[model samples]
Target: MKENLTDSAYAAGWALVKRLPEPVATRLFDGIADFVWRRRGKSVLRLESNLRRVRPEATDAEITALTRAGMRSYMRYWCESFRMSTWSRERVLASFEPEDVHRLDEAMASGRGAVLALPHMGNWDLAGAWVVVRGMPFTTVAERLKPEKLFDRFVAYREGLGMEVLPLTGGAGTLGKLAQRLRAGGLVCLVGDRDLSASGVPVEFLGEAARMPAGPAALAAQTGAALLPVTLWYDGTPVMKGRVHEEVPAPAEGSKREKVAAMTQAMADVWGEGVRAHPGDWHMLQRFWLADLEPRPEESVLPDPQGVQ
Candidate 1:
C-alpha cells in the first residue's frame, strides 16, 4: 500500500540470478558484456550525456571506456546482490575493504542513529547486504516504482537480508522508526543522490547544478542523526568506504534554511568528487537538469534545504 511496484520482471530476473551458482553467474556476466555495452537505447545515450555533463574533461574514448566499465559493474552488482543470500560472511566481507568503516562503528557504539547517505556510484545494493551481515540494523527509503509487483519483489529481497525497506512516501513516518533504531545505536542507509520527484534542493554538481532529494539531510537534522558519507567503488574489487564527514548538526542554532543548505552542499561536494573520480559509476539515466525538461518551474531557484526541515 505504501509503494507502487512494477511487473514481476525484476523479480523474475532476480529469481533466475539466484538459481545460478557464483561461477556461472560470473561467467554469464562477462559473456553478456558486449550486449550490455552496445549503446542501443535512449537510456544509455542519456546516461552518456549525463556523464559528459558531469565530467566535461572526459574524452569520447574515456567516456566509452567508462560506459563499458559501468555496464560490467552493473552486471556484477546484480550478480553479487542475488548471491548474498548464499554467501558466507567471509565471502561477503571479502568484497568490502572499508577505508573508514570505523567511523560508522564508532557512531553506532554511541547509541545515536547514524545516516549512511549513499549515491549512485558503485554497488550500493551490495553495500546494504554487507551492512546486514555485519549486524547493523539497516533500513532505507525506496521510491515507489510504477506497477506494484516489482516493488514488492525488491522489498522482499531487502527484507530477506534483514533490512527494513520503507517506501519514500511513508518514509517520513519511518523516520521515527529509524530514529528509534538509531537511538538504540543502529544504522540507516539512504540514497541521497537522486531527485525522485524533482522536488529536491539544488546543489552544484559536475559542472552544473543538479537537484538531490532533501530526505537524507532533513531526516538527519530532524532526528539529530549523524550523516555519514559512504562511497562505493571498484578498486579492481568492489570496495566501500565510509567516511564520517563532519556530523550533520541540526539547524536548531542557525536559520533552518541556511543549515540545511550547508549540509546539502557538503553532501553535493562529496558526491561530485566521487562522480569525477569514477564518472561512469554514476547511473543517472533520466533527463536530469531543469533545462532538459520541457516546462521549467515558474519560481526555479536553488532548493532551500532549511525549508524542508
Candidate 2:
C-alpha cells in the first residue's frame, strides 16, 4: 500500500511537471531548492558532505554556499528530466554542446564501439538524448527501485528517449549482454562514479578512498572498445554542457583482474578532475568516501553479475 502511494505520487508529480511552462517550472524548482536548502534536509546535508570531499579547501561558509547551489543544480536536473520527453529532436540536439564529441564519433566509426563512463552531474538524460538524436541509441543499466510500478515508469521514460534499458538485477548474463552489444558496435553508457555492487574496485578519488563501478572498464577490456570518460554540467544557461575526455586505453599488459583495477582507478582520476572544476554540479547526495561509510556485516561475496570489479 505504501509502495503504491509512493509510486502514484511520483507519477503524478512527473505528469504535472511535464505540463508546466519552462519558465514556470524553473521558478518552481528554484523555490523548491531554496526550501530544501533552508530546511537543511537530509539530502541537502548529504550533498554538502559530498561537496566537502570535492572542495577540501572550502571553509564552512563556502561549503554552505556551494551546497545551496548544488541543491539548485540538482533540482534543475529533475526539472529537465521530467520535461525532456517532450523536447523535439532539434531542441535536444541543440541543448547539449559536447566538447570532443569526435572522440566518440571516431570510436563508433572505427567499429570498435565506445563505453561512456559518466559521473552523476548535470542532466545525463539530455546527453543521452543528444546521442540518440545523432543516430546512435545507447544501452544502459537502471537500478531497480522499490515499488515495481515506479521502476517500470522509469524504464518506460528512458526507453521513450531512445535508450535500451536493462535491469541491473538481471543476473550474470547482464554483463555478457552488454559486451555483446559493444562488440556489435553499439554504445554503452555506465554511471561510473558510485559502486552499486558489492565487488566494486577501490580507488582514490578526490584525495579519499572510495569504490567505483568497474563495468565500464571491464566492458571495454572484454570487447576491445574505447573507454571514454564524460562529464556534464549546467553552465547557468538553458543549454547543458559536457566534455568527452580522451580514451583511457586498456593496459598493454596485465592480468584481466589487474587491468580492470588499473582502468577503474584511472577513470576515477579523470572524474575527480571534472568534479573539482564543477563541484556544485556533482549531485552526489549520499555518503561516498570510505571514511563516511558505515560498517557492513561480513558475508560471502558473490561475483558481480554486471562484471564490475
Candidate 3:
C-alpha cells in the first residue's frame, strides 16, 4: 500500500511538477525546503552532521545557517530534476557549463573511454542531460529504488534523456558492460562520493575516514578509461556551475589492488577540495564517515538537517 503511494507520488512529480510555471514552482519548492528544514527530520540531521565535518571550526550558529542553505540547495536539485525534461536543447546547453571540459573532449577524441566521477552535489541529472544534448550519450548506474514500479519510473526518466541506465544490483555483468562501453570509446558516469556497498575503498575525506565506491577507479584501471573527477555547485543563477579537475592517473608502480586504492584515495582528495569550497551545494544527507557507523548513546538526539539539526 505504502509503496504504491510512493511510486504514485513520483509519477505525479514527473507528470505535474514539470508543468509548473517557473516562479510558482520556485516558491513552492522553496517553501517545502523551509518546512522540512524546520522539521529537522532524520535526513536533515544527517546532512547537518556531515556538513560539520566540512567546517569543524564553525560555531553552532554558523552551522545552522550553513545547513539551512544546504537544504535550499538540495531542494533546488529536486526542483531542477523534476523540471529538466521540459528543457530544450538550447536551454540544456546554456545551463550548467563546466570549466576545463576540454579534458573530457581530449579523452573522447583519443578513442579511450572517459569515466566522469562526480560527488552527490548540485544537479547531476541536469549535468547528464547537458552532455547528452551535446551529442555524447553516456552510460550510468543507478541504485534501485524500492517498489519496482518506482525504479522503472526513474530508469525511464533517464532513458528518455538519452542515458543508458543500469541497475547497481541485479544487473548482471555490470562491470563487464561498463568495460565494453569504455573499449568502444564511450563515456561512463558514476556518483563516486558514497560507499553504497560495504566493500568500498577506505580514504580520508573532509579530514575524516570515509569509504567511497571503488568501482570508478577499478573501471578506469581495468579499461584504461580516463578517471576524471568532476565537482558541481550552484550560484544564485539558474545555471549549474562546476569544474572538471584533472584526471587521477593510476599509479605507475602498484599491484592491481594497490592501484585501485591509490586512485580512489586521490579521487577522494579531489572531492574534499570541492566539498570544502562549496559546502552548501553538497547534498550528503546520510551517514558517511566510518566513525558514524559506530554505536553511540547520543545519536538519537542529533540535530536533523532542518532548522535545529
| Tens-place lDDT digits, model 1, residues 261-309 | 7788788888778777776566565566655665544221111111112
lDDT of 2 by residue, 5-52 (tens): 878877876799989989999999889888888988666777888888
Which 10 consecutive positions of candidate 3 have the poorest summed lDDT? Answer: 300-309
**Model 3 residue 96 distance off true place after TM-score fit, in angstroms:** 1.0
Count of steric clashes across candidates, in order: 6, 1, 8
lDDT of every predicted structure (CA atoms) = 0.67, 0.85, 0.85
Off by over 4 Å in 2: 295-309
Q: How does model 3 score by TM-score?
A: 0.94
- Sliding window of 10 residues with minimal summed lDDT for model 1: 300-309
- TM-score for each predicted model, relative to the true structure: 0.84, 0.94, 0.94
Model 2: residue 53 alpha-carbon error in angstroms: 1.5
TM-score for candidate 1: 0.84
**TM-score, candidate number 2:** 0.94
What is the Å distance of residue 305 in model 1 from its true position? 26
How far off is model 1, as Cα RMSD? 5.7
